[model samples]
Target: MHTTHHCKARQSQRGISLKMVNYVLTHGALENDKIVLGKKEAMQRLADLEREKRLLMKIADKGGVVVVADGEALITTYNCSHRN
Candidate 1:
């Protein structure tokens, strides 16, 4: 997550947030040492998330609440009827 001064300047100029850079790092395909998230890869990742959301929705419809946590800290909670 470390950014060089030049990188920070370019990011400001390009309006690319650190969050977006992290997303590309996490999900992007590796080319040599660089990570690249092209349009196709981005679309595929979004589609995969959508499929997971649908599955979670089905469970929620069955009166299940999906709780996502990190260790003991709750990250998110959701159901078909409500979200927290």
Candidate 2:
């Protein structure tokens, strides 16, 4: 869950909260070096977590999230234009 200063700045600039970033990191799919959670993937994950109402409510947004990771630390995160 570690993030660089640059990543924190980007999160503030992009209005992407740390909670959302954590959600993407926990649920997103690995594509190359990034973890991506698009609308489609989010929907699928939502369905999978349907029984967990609280968890499901947390990640109900279909907006895409792309997280770049360096080992266990997070390098950066941004909203996905193409995936949404």
> What's the CA error at residue 65 for candidate 1, in Å?
8.6
- Measured against the true structure, the TM-scores of the candidates, in listed sequence, are 0.72, 0.53
Q: Which regions in candidate 1 have their CA more than 4 angstroms from the true location? A: 65-84
lDDT for each candidate structure:
0.88, 0.82
Collision count of model 1: 0
Model 2 / residue 7 / CA error / Å: 0.6
For model 2, how does the per-residue alpha-carbon lDDT over 1-84 read when each residue is reduced to its tens digit? 579999999999999998899999998889999999999988888777776775545444535567999899999987564752
lDDT tens digits, residue span 1-84, model 1: 678999999999999999999999898889998999999988998999999999988896767877899999999986545545
Best by TM-score: 1
Q: Over the full model, what C-alpha lDDT does candidate 2 score relative to the true structure?
A: 0.82
Q: Considering every candidate listed, which one attains the maximal lDDT?
A: 1
Candidate 2's clash total is 0
Lowest lDDT sum, 10 consecutive residues, model 1, at 75-84
